[model samples]
Target: MQTWLVQHQKLLSQQLAQGRLAHAILLAGVAGAGKLSLANWLVQVVLCRQVQKNNDQGILSPCNSCKACRLYHQGSYPDFLSVTSDSKNIGVDDIRRISAFVETTAHLGKNKIVLLPMAEKMTTAAANALLKTLEEPGLSCVLILVSDDLDMLLPTITSRCRLYDIRPLSGQALLESLNRGQTQENLFANVSQLPELTDEQVHEQFRQFTARLLDFIIKRQNRGALLALLNENTYAFRWLEYMLVTMARSQYNWLSWSALRVKLVTAEGKSAATGAAPGDAIGQLPDSETIWQIYQLVVGCIKQLKSMVQVNAAYLSEKLLVDIETRLDK
Candidate 1:
């Protein structure tokens, strides 16, 4: 387990020790924050048949040698249901299946666990159907919902569950945690010259890079700066996608800074309010429609980077930057 998860684990284990575990748990956090891992760990603790006593702390722990634990580790646990959708949205049928699974008895005489990853992808009908199950889940059933964007979920669904917000660790902490059992390679090269950078420093760098890119696009200036950033790191495409999304939200005054985990910093080194519209420096910023079009283009470029066929990073970046500039010009 990572250092960030240790604290959460201790809290959750205490809840279990006190017999205060909720029937439904909602793990909310940004992508790569280990919500799913934490959920999995919690489920394992619940499903483990034998409880081993910790000699040091005098606490109970999951015994991995038990039949239940072995089955779960092998991915053949009959009482465990992991629901995920390959389609763009999870439909009512998915929820119905989960409901049926919950209605059945637990095979191991332990708790039945249902894990729903990307719960926000559920459609309205699906969410409504799941609400019924959440309201009346049996005594031995546990439902875990993981979502990267909690705002996208229905309030009714979230209101009934015990919510746990997971946050990412800072640079030195994250590095130390990740490096516990592995060798360290290049991790902070793109963000700074130092070997490590705090989370705030990384976000600040991202904000500045994004602001400069938008300025170039809005002014119809050369994209040499943007290209230079892209050339420095392959992850720049992903950063560009995030910047475009932020800009879209800013233009429509729908920016959720806390949810997005980004602090918009202006070139003047001032923190910009999420509700404020962007500056009118190139006349008006592109309208929402144009922004969406540019955003989609950036998304496509990002997808191309992951294709099995090799893509020319410089060429793609230049094309995407010019296309965005042309759209803003219109």
Candidate 2:
């Protein structure tokens, strides 16, 4: 129930109240937009046998006393399915399993819900495997897709979903709300990675990669930071862009505007987007030719994968690695 997401909850709850919610929902936004939180909230509301509305706002919330709510809270809800992955991509097998689960009847005789926190991380095969399920998600099955980047998902997937764009409050509004209800520091770090907003462990993992990349680029001192691994990550290209922005900010002493949209201004100053001189830290950097090639390789790979043709995802990732290595890791 983050402040910025309260309106979304109310809007979704009102839809549920009217029995007009879609079978498949896509909550699309930036990292700090609370996509997963909103998904979880919607799932709880759907699963609650006795949903209660707040007196002040009329927004519905789960009645935790009911058997269904109890089971869900215990993490043993038979009707709830969350597709997850340990590796960089969710493979075809994972989608097949979920598709089978979707076909089954709900154990509670109520609605079933499937949560895909990183829908965009599904491999090309996995996404294709999921098309049948997405196209025909019955009334009993409520599939909730949470994606920070819609561009990474297949068009068929995005087209089938009832989309909701979850945007955050900004400027004075965000600052005032946060100031009024500030809690722990970790809860509001103002960083923008989807994993960073939801899970601390994953956030740490991403930052570790960022640190290693900084070492590789800034110090030429690598601690096992490989561009090949970025090929496997769904957010690889975005992460590269994020790193460069950070580098640029540090180099020029910019005010550190976040791509995630949590704006902050400190040490007030002006920064022009000017390239550094030859042999300068920022000038010898960027290496536009190499970065552009990397960008092109990624765009090509994504285009091939998200389309209908059954291209080999593994082959694409491998090709990306090969194309970037000679150019990137010098």
Candidate 3:
């Protein structure tokens, strides 16, 4: 168990002891809050015929000896259903399958568990389809919704579920806890950049790229070195978007994770104009607005790359770097 989540686990245990655990549970938090882990623990406890108690927090865990536990651990549990998406959106068809699953009886003659990780990824149609299930979650069934950003989810979807807002430790508290000798793997396990940082080589590549980007932004250095690195790495645009996001948050004294996530969704799109405003500092680091503007520009470049249109990626990359330089100098 993550030490930061020990308190949350205790609260959950208290709720379970009082027999007040909601069937439709929504564990909402930012990316690194470990809400998905909590959802997993709850599902294990629900499926276990015999639950074991933790002496520390008095939290309940599954008895791995049980038949249900064995099946679940083996990924062969018939009563358990998870709706996942490889793409950006979870479509209506996925939600319809969930409805079909909820209409059935539990194979274990106990609780049927359904988990929807990143539930906010559900499309408009998917969210609407899920409303029917949320309104009438069948007998002896538990539906768990794990979301990184609650703002992306529809109000109607959230209203039907019991919400537990699990927050991540930030700033000093985060540093203190993580410094207690946590390994790199454990630290990055729940980060949004996991897919990009696959190996040591890739990790070092990003580390250097981040350093160069800071030099370009804060030190007002030439863009030649940065542009070279950007053109080399196919994922450079995403790295810039991610770094600018962090810098933007730090610019605001490390803004709240939830609040930053909201800004990420609501920030303005790419603009036609690219230069800095009149009277803007010639060589100083940009303000918050400029940081977000550059973020949107990078996102635009990424989108263009994803499209079917014939694009000169190297030209696009150079154009973005040039635009950033132009924006830095009024």
Candidate 4:
């Protein structure tokens, strides 16, 4: 468990100890915040026949040797149901399957757990189908819904479950956590604007890609650099969108994750050459209106990428870079 989840784990432990655990729990947080991990941990606790409680800290944990825990670890737990969407949305059939699972008896004489990893992806009919089961779940059934955006869920679905909001750790804490076992050079290299990235190599690559994109934008030239970066990474559109948003926030003197990342990257480069303290070069970004216009342009390109008809990525990227240069010229 990460340090960020310690408090939530303790709270849920207390509820379990008192036999007051809710039948349905809605775990809400941004992507990569470990909401799914927390839900899985909670399921193990609820299903474990031998749950251990530390007298000193009063933390609850599952005993791995228990039959229920063993089955879960082996991925052969009959009572556990994990639901996910294959298409754009989880249709009513998915919810109906969950309902059927809930109606069955637990095979391990423990709580039957049904986990929906992306609850927000459920269609309206699917959500409606889940309402009645959430209201009156089986005596030993637990439903856990994990969502990156709680607002996308139906009000009736959210209102029926106990909501637990998870948050990212502070910048310093997060840096320390992510930098464990990493050298100083690699530590700074791996810093990212993303809220969370579990893989160090992927994080570092993303940072590098973002840096190149930022260099082109800040210089208001370097069309070649922009094209090179886009050609090398499939996630160029996402990086461009992030850069535009950061520039917009910088104009308002607001410090977003991307804005902070921009400052860090710029400061590192400047400090290496001039021997001066790192400063906020992000404040030199273009005006807010200009940034918004560029952002909308990137947004449109992203939608086009998602269209049914195939679009040439290289051509689209070049066109976007040209449009951005034009905007900067004005």
Candidate maximizing TM-score: 4
Tell me model 1's lDDT, rounded to 2 decimals. 0.71
TM value for model 3: 0.66
Worst 10 residues of 1 by lDDT: 184-193
Off by over 4 Å in 2: 123-125, 135-139, 170-177, 180-211, 223-239, 246-330
* lDDT score, candidate 4: 0.74
Which of the predicted structures, 2 or 4, would earn the higher TM-score when compared with the native?
Answer: 4
Using TM-score as the measure, name the better of candidate 1 and candidate 3: 3
Candidate 1, TM-score vs. the true structure? 0.60
Clashing pairs in 4: none
Q: Order the candidates by lDDT, highest first — what do you get? A: 4, 3, 1, 2
lDDT at residue 77 of model 3 (Cα atoms): 88
Model 2, position 66, has a per-residue lDDT of: 96
The models' CA-based lDDT, in order, is 0.71, 0.68, 0.73, 0.74
Candidate 2 lDDT by residue in tens digits, 157-213: 898899998877654455465563442223234445444434566554555555455
On a 0 to 100 scale, what is the lDDT of residue 155 in model 1?
Answer: 97
Q: For candidate 3, what is the lDDT?
A: 0.73
Query: 173-282, model 1: which lDDT tens digit per residue?
Result: 55565553232212232222222233455445555566566557555554787688876753466677766776678776785433232234344534332223443223
Candidate 3 structure quality by residue, lDDT tens digits, 49-163: 8888867768888889899999999999899998898766788999999889978877778878999998977877899999877778346778999987787788998988899
